[model samples]
Target: MPRIELKTEIKANKNIVFDLSRSIDLHKISTEHTNEQAIAGKTNGLIGMNESVTWRAKHFGIYQNLTSKITEFNKPNYFADEMVKGAFKEFKHEHHFAELNEGTLMTDFFIYKSPFGILGKIADKLFLKKYMTQLLTERNRIVKDFAESDKWKEILA
Candidate 1:
């Protein structure tokens, strides 16, 4: 298993940042690489406790579908999503938000295991770790931009 962690400060309150981060609409807006929709469980609203959704997207030039369930959710603070079905052997993502003097500290922890035995370990060490980190950094940048701008407000409204 490989773990990747990313943190960024957003110029918004914890609740606002958390809400936006978990918003399905916001997810679509933030990533050009994904065409995702909430196919089940609170499709159009804030993802609640134990809710599940399926995301369809193109990754590594191949179409992939991932179904995830919200295993843990604490409003304005933290949440965790675990993969029920996906490409990886196992996947878990944990999101944390904390209010700070300047803004909110948003952190993401992603853990995943590749399917290929020892080859997966080698790939993770050689490339996957950095690739995951970069992807998370891009996601954080988009979220930060959206949270700090009026765009997010308009979308939410």
Candidate 2:
């Protein structure tokens, strides 16, 4: 499995950052590459432990529907989501938030494995890794912008 970690500082409180990060609406907004909707389990609020949601989106020019479950949830701190079914051989994403002097430190840890063995490795080495990294960077930028702006507060409220 390949793991990608990204961290960014947001000019918002840890609680606010964490809450916004967990919102499906924010997820959809941050991930412009994918069109996702929460089809189950607290579709409109903060997702909790053991909850499950199915997100239908387009990835790599293919429509994909991934069913994931919240394996861990610690409010204002950390959470983990594991893919039950998706395009990967395995996938797990852990999100962490911490309070800092300036604001909040938000981190994303993604562990994933491609389907085909040697071909997957080659694809990752050639393009997928960089693409995923860029995607994460863009997502982080959107999240940071949303969290720092008052628009996020209005949406959350």
Candidate 3:
């Protein structure tokens, strides 16, 4: 399994940032390049604990569908989503938020086990890990953009 961790500092309220982070609509905006869309289950709005969403997207010239569910949540503080059915053997993403006087600190812990034992390990070292990191970084950038600006109201409302 490979783990990717990232921390972002956003000059926004924790609650607002939290909502933006979990917004299906915002995610669709961020991943427009990949043509990612929520096809079923909690297709829009903020996803809550135990909620699930199936996403269809084009990746590496191929279209794939992945479903993940919010397995754990604590509101503006923390949440974890695990893969229900996807390309990966298994995966879990944990989001953490801490309120600060100046802003909010958001962190993500993404761990996953790829399919195909040895091929997966080699793939991670070659390009899979970097690809996943880039995807997450881009997603987080959009989250930050919305949270730091009034644009957040477009989706959160």
Best by lDDT: 3
Give the per-residue lDDT digits (tens) of candidate 3, residues 1-157. Answer: 8999999999999999999989999999999999999999999989999999999999989999999999999988999999999999999999999987789999999999999999999999999999999999999999999999999989888
List candidate 1 segments past 4 Å from native.
Answer: 36-42
| Candidate 1 backbone collisions, by pair | none
> Of the candidates numbered 1 and 2, which has the greater lDDT value?
2
lDDT of 2 at 146: 79
User: Which residue pairs come into collision in candidate 2?
Assistant: none
Q: Indicate the worst ten consecutive residues by lDDT in candidate 3.
A: 97-106
Q: How many residue pairs clash per model?
A: 0, 0, 0
lDDT against the true structure, each candidate:
0.81, 0.83, 0.95
What is the descending lDDT order? 3, 2, 1
Question: Where is model 3 more than 4 Å wrong at Cα?
Answer: none
**Model 1 C-alpha lDDT per residue in residues 3-114, reported as the tens digit of each score:** 8888898888777788887877776665567565566555665676888888777767788888888899989899999999988888999999998887999989999998
TM-score ranking, best first:
3, 2, 1
Per-residue error at 139 for model 2, in Å?
2.2
Residue 49 in candidate 1, Cα distance off native in Å: 1.0
- Superposed by TM-score, candidate 1 places the C-alpha of residue 133 at a distance from the truth, in angstroms, of 1.8
